[model samples]
Target: MLLHLPEGGRVVHEEHAPITLPKGWFRVIRQREYVPGSVRIVAD
Candidate 1:
């Protein structure tokens, strides 16, 4: 999975050591441009 940021930065989830997501850092999109099950990291 490739995590794309708003600032154009990207985090690639390689086969080894995928990122352990923090709590309350993901957004669930039911509909829209974003794909289902795709997570967008929320900025604090």
Candidate 2:
């Protein structure tokens, strides 16, 4: 099942760029400078 935050919001589709989700105006982490394969998920 897919989970959606804020229930509903606006979505902007762009051909030259990625689709932007305006819901809640949450900031997305675009990119980080680091060594390759350093990203990982940890359970709390």
Candidate 3:
């Protein structure tokens, strides 16, 4: 899905880009390890 924003508006802001995994979960690249199931919250 994609969303377009024009200028600005009242809203909460967050961003994420992840690589899909075979386990039906995804992971974001970072310097350190990511605890298991952590992505689930972000997915929600």
Task: Provide the TM-score for each candidate, comma-separated.
Answer: 0.21, 0.20, 0.19
> Could you give candidate 3's per-residue lDDT for residues 1-44 as a string of tens digits?
32333432333335655433233223343344457765332332
- Give me the runs in candidate 3 sitting further than 4 Å from their true place: 9-44
Measured with C-alpha atoms, the lDDT of residue 7 in candidate 2 is 48
Q: Which regions in candidate 1 have their CA more than 4 angstroms from the true location?
A: 1-14, 28-44
Error of 2 at 19 (Å): 0.8
Worst 10 residues of 2 by lDDT: 22-31
Model 2: residue 3 alpha-carbon error in angstroms: 19
Q: Report each candidate's C-alpha RMSD, comma-separated, in the order given.
A: 12.7, 9.4, 12.8
- Give the alpha-carbon lDDT of every model: 0.45, 0.48, 0.38
Clashing pairs in 1: none
Query: CA shift at 4, candidate 3, in angstroms?
Result: 0.4
Candidate topping lDDT:
2
Tens-place lDDT per residue, model 1, 1-44, is 33434444333555565454443334544433445777555432
State the lDDT of candidate 2 residue by residue for 1-44, as single tens digits: 24355744554545454554544435544444555768544322
Number of the predicted model whose TM-score against the real structure is largest: 1
Residue-pair clashes, model 2: 0
